[model samples]
Target chain A: MAELSEDRIAAYAASRLPGARDVAVSGLARISGGASRETYRLRLRYVDADGRSVERPLILRRDPPASLIETERHIEFAAYRAFHGSPVPVPQMLWLEEDPAHLDYPFFVAEELTGFESSPGALTGEAYDPVREKLGRRKWTILGEISRADPEALGLTTVMAKVAPEDCWRRELDYWEGVLDEDEVTPQPIIRAAIRWLRANPPPPAQKISVVHGDFRTGNFLYDAAGEIHGILDWEMAHLGDPLEDLGWGLNRIWCWGQNDLRGGLLPRDQAIAVWEQASGLKADPAALHWWELFNCVKGQGIWVSGAKAWSDGETRDPILIISAWRMFNPQDRAALELMGRL
Target chain B: MKPDPDAVLGYLAGLMVQTIAPQVQPQYLAGVIGMSGMLLGMAAQEWDRAADRLVKENRAIRGLFRQAERVGLDADLAQEVRALAGGQDDDLRISALESVNTGLRAALISLHAAVETRTDAASRALNDAIWAELSASTSRRAYTGSPF
Candidate 1:
């Protein structure tokens, strides 16, 4: 199959905007590092239904041939649409295309949250030096808003599977462990140990179930120098589970960006938790949070191992997979060890 | 071999990321080129150390099995550990060494778990030793660019 052409995208946009004329898609450049989707930024220009000239910048996320995580695009679209204009800032979802005949893959187009940096490496630099604390506060606080959100209220319950608070931990653990089982090309002794430990000791039921931003980490969000979080991206992993799961994932040591002391390379672990606690108006419950944090190590490893398996098996040759495997495998183990109090 | 393999990889990686990636059209492919370069960089680092790291780690894990035998693990686990403790990575090929390493590490997990169960002082000491070895194992496999 041929790669998707920009003209085809413009034609699809024209079809969607029935009354719009001269629908053109330009600047369709693919952004790197989205292992789960083919993300592209494009400039869309057209004359609207009112014969009004309009120019807009948009992001197009289309499904790839095979990806690390399999998720429902509709769910992601719904999650973004649900969060639009809410406390959790997300790009306005414009159109969701499930029929592949137009673009050759299921994709969604949304208004791009432009002019912001999303690189984790940039966060470690001197540029974000001034507002690191403020950014950290905003990061977890927004997570708090997401955790405090009601799926039913947000019309997300229909798309995201409903999970009871008590079973949240088990459900997530089983899913990731199963992935490790099928996808692990190498024996992950540390992950296997972590899994047994997780099963042996499970976190308490969630305080209250909230919308879990399945991949809520510093790199997933749009941050500016003034310490503002414009958008919380990557809802492909969005689900309803223990809110602590998201909190733990953010606090996962693998995200420390080589600075083990600074969780997510933004704030100290305790400080990040405190900011989250204050914003969520909930307790971190040291023991339960610790369990979730360790569990996230296993989850993190599962993702990396799967990426390795995918690349090795020739399913996809995305260098990101090799990077994830080579770059993350050890850090994940170290993180697990630290969480287990063995480090 | 006159030009060091690592140096060659480093040069290629630099060109790919600095020159090729920037000049590539359609940002996604550019990004792939950039990351491929980075992957090459990491591959270079791992290539030189792969054999030494695997040999040292396999030896360390085998030594741990010897300690597990002294601590007196479960009958079945002890038997397995004892057999592995006397084993050798005679085949020094990376693939062969990795195969042995995988089995040894698997047995180590079993030994570690069994040691955790016993309340004996030796078991406690052995358990701690296993953790130390495990920590060392991760450090051996460490990629400089790892986030954690």
Candidate 2:
């Protein structure tokens, strides 16, 4: 529990609701296993203007003292708004409070879509065995729908800085490589070598400056036994950039959590791409996809190293950070090596 | 040797995390204590075999570096290889062995890269050796919870 107690949350809710009374919050328990944000599930009960009692389940995602990836809450809120009620399902975001007075740090509240498993290992279990293909189709198809969305029309361009098609690769590469340079505790010769190679062979200008769901992959979505994806979560890294960037990220080998060539612990890599291509009506140019694939390895390594640095520096004290850093570092390096054709 | 130090450390770590940390206050301290538990767990896994793994890997890297020198290589890289190959872990401390290992690995990467660009059969064979050493090095460092 944070300094802001359940009473404070209820008080805040009462103020937001014009005719509500006796606004109370209960069942305020923190959900385990989020390194970037502290997630809590609570129930909000209040008497409405009609004198009817209403209850709603809500989730609070508060910014941690330090995070694995620094991201904007507003961008995630805007991304939710952009996808809600569309083919790409997302929880409806209610409030984004940037004021530290409310909570020591920025936070956002959204509808809690319960009754679904989101773990990467869950998808590989026997319970989901029958619906694997269906889930796979929905996963990539929703990504295709995201790729199909217009950033300008969705008002994302105003929030996500627009990048030139050719500059997209450079901007993303530079940013992630910068993270690696800043956070690396040890020499990463493999990643350093890959960075050099990426610079030597930059991808072609993006086919379209589509919205890139920066961390779009397995374990980032809510799914059930019926092969339905309820909500796309973790849009904190959402931005407008090369669409192929998302495709490449999805195709990264690390997301092959099932330990197969298939991506996202779901469908085969080519099949997943096929679904995306068919839905978005875009060709995944081989050379461009290859560059982005290798670039993602660099990006992944950057994220893992940053996790290690965050733990080492004592900026954040979360077990997930330690778990992430130790588990992902060497694998990320190996992925980079494989991408650079060294393995 | 009867009750392995590694097993005892791991048991103590489990006790600290599962039995003790939760009872503490100031959530931040609990997290620190939890991480200390993890460090202990990792240390327990590493403690007993650290010297053995380092010794084996140092010997392996030295042999590879010597093989690299036998190949007709660029003079500067060959000298670098010769210098690394001639070195030994004089100080038996884990930190000292680690320092020497880091130096050898860095040299290995350079040698591997050098041989990667060459067309000679000896360069190719040396490249294979370097890759094997790199693979072995990762395996040696791999922990129980590693994703790979």
Candidate 3:
């Protein structure tokens, strides 16, 4: 792998901007908690074709050699592009480069949503206490908007794989179960039992096929002290599926960062569901939602173990991978058990 | 060792989080240092209890296997369960105990699955026992500061 430097990014940016001059890149510092991508914050300076000197703060999301999840860069780029001007609040994507020769791997650049907090741990402090409920409402409302939006209208159907309402649960369950089979270092009897139960008792067909943000937890979004969400980020796992999938993922018990009954350390489980139902204008059938919630536990374990496998194999040395595996593995199991009424 | 490994690891974790992380640049390295400190704390917690946890868990699974005799599994699985049931944990090393534990747990999954198929009272009871053990297993491996 070639070393990623400021000059390489500048050269690439220059190439993208055909008539730009004095193209320079600086202040290149990596961001944290990107186990799937090498995320960096950089400053780009150039004199454009319009004879104007421009300086912009941008984000670079480059593919690592190995990642917790294997996803198509083009699909991720398209997801962000489709939802940029919509109510989704994603950063405007600038470029997507697949040729690894320029940056040692495929990467994309987008405008950075700076100066906002994205950590779930930050919400635990007293400073965020007053705004927690507002943030929770906004969180699920944005997710509701994402779920209710038409994939065909957004041009997402062209990029995302089409799945029928009935097949959504199986497709997702099979994919994650296969991930567990391949990556898990220890026996996952609990998840295995949950998988069997899910297969035996499938959920009803999705009310309507909608965009499922593969990850829609509290920490994935940028928020302000006023409890407003600015950008709903990390759409790398975005796909077309049952809309309830996103809600189930957000409602997963492992995301209860306060280690309490509060889901996402924000709202109580019922209130979050209510907020999502109102925003999306769709009913969350209790039984169907329960199935997806349990399934998300299996999916969650798959992600943690995949990261553990990557670190164990020496493919990447990102401490977040090990931290996730160590911190999340048991909670994920416990979450599954709770969903299965076995906890 | 003059000082205990748990104490040394705890001190190292504090140094990394309170001392080293604050001085790191670029913000990302600081976050990594902090997370490393957290991992060291987890490592310290595990160091003292790992061997004891594995031994107790191994013994518990062996007892479950002993009860598997009446579940009437297939011949191969029954023989396998019997064999595993008779085995003892003579090696006190964590690695050896863990290796045996893995095999037992893998077998436990098979037993649990087979037990689930039978509708008899004994099979049902054994199935519930397996679920109880599975739940207990998570509790055993759980960390003190887990977000769940």
- lDDT per residue for candidate 1 within A1-343, as digits (tens), equals 6677779988899999988998998887888747899888899999999999999999999998788888899988999999999999998999999998888899999999889999888889998889998999999899988888888999988888988889999999999999998988788777888888889898889999888889999789998999999999999998889889999999988888877788888999889989888888889999999899999998998999888998888988888888888888888899899888887
Per-candidate DockQ values are 0.73, 0.24, 0.80
For the predicted complex of model 2, DockQ is 0.24
Residue-level lDDT for A273 in candidate 1: 89
**Winner on DockQ (1 vs 2):** 1
* Predictions in order: lDDT: 0.88, 0.83, 0.92
- Candidate 3 regions exceeding 4 Å error are none
Docking class of 1: medium
lDDT of 3 by residue, A1-343 (tens): 5678999999999999999999999999997846789899999999999999999999999998899999998998998999898888999999999998899899999998888999999898899999999999999999999999999999999999999998999999999999999999888889888888999899999999998889999899999999999999888899999999999999998888954777899999999999999999999999999999999999999999999999999999999999989999999999998888888
Listed per candidate, the RMSD to the true structure in angstroms reads 1.8, 4.0, 1.0
Model 2 TM-score is 0.86
lDDT for residue A21 in candidate 1, whole number 0-100: 97
Q: List the residue pairs that clash in candidate 1.
A: A258-B147
Residue range B37-140, candidate 2, lDDT tens digits: 87788889989889989988888989998998668878898888899889887788998888887788777767766776677888888877776666666677
Fraction of native contacts in model 2? 0.12
- The deviation in Å at residue B137 for candidate 3 is 1.3
lDDT of 2 at A94: 86
Give the alpha carbon lDDT tens digit for every residue of B21-120 in model 3.
9899979999999999999999999998999999989988998999989888899999999999999989999999989998998998888888886899
